[model samples]
Target: MHKRFLIIVIGLFLLFPLLGRAVDSNQQILQLRAQIEELQKKANEYRKIVATS
Candidate 1:
């Protein structure tokens, strides 16, 4: 039982960093998506101006 417990503890220690990295990447992706949406909105406004002119 002690050996199994030791193994699980080691596994969790190793896994924590990988989970943290995944969270970081997801945050980056979300930020980029927001930027893209903002750019698209700007482009749409420019299109309207061009059409009116």
Candidate 2:
């Protein structure tokens, strides 16, 4: 019973950081910026290919 309680406590501690990050606005903004930049790069490449073809 003691081991099981310790395991549950450890699991909750490990999960807290992930829960915190899920609600973090700064991280969300950075992720959005990265995705937008990647998509823009892909669009530019596609435009160049279409122009040449």
Q: Cα RMSD (Å) per model?
A: 0.4, 6.0
Residues 8-46, model 1: lDDT tens digits: 999999999999999999999999999999999999999
Worst 10 residues of 2 by lDDT: 18-27
Compute the lDDT of residue 33 as modeled in candidate 1: 100
What would the per-residue lDDT of candidate 2 be over residues 1-53, giving only the tens digit for each residue? 99999999999999999889877977899999999999999999999999999
Superposed by TM-score, candidate 1 places the C-alpha of residue 29 at a distance from the truth, in angstroms, of 0.3
Model 1 shows how many backbone clashes?
0
The prediction achieving the highest lDDT against the true structure is 1
Full-model lDDT for every candidate: 1.00, 0.96
Please give the distance, in angstroms, between residue 7's alpha carbon in candidate 2 and its true position after superposition: 36
Stretches of candidate 1 exceeding 4 Å from the true structure: none
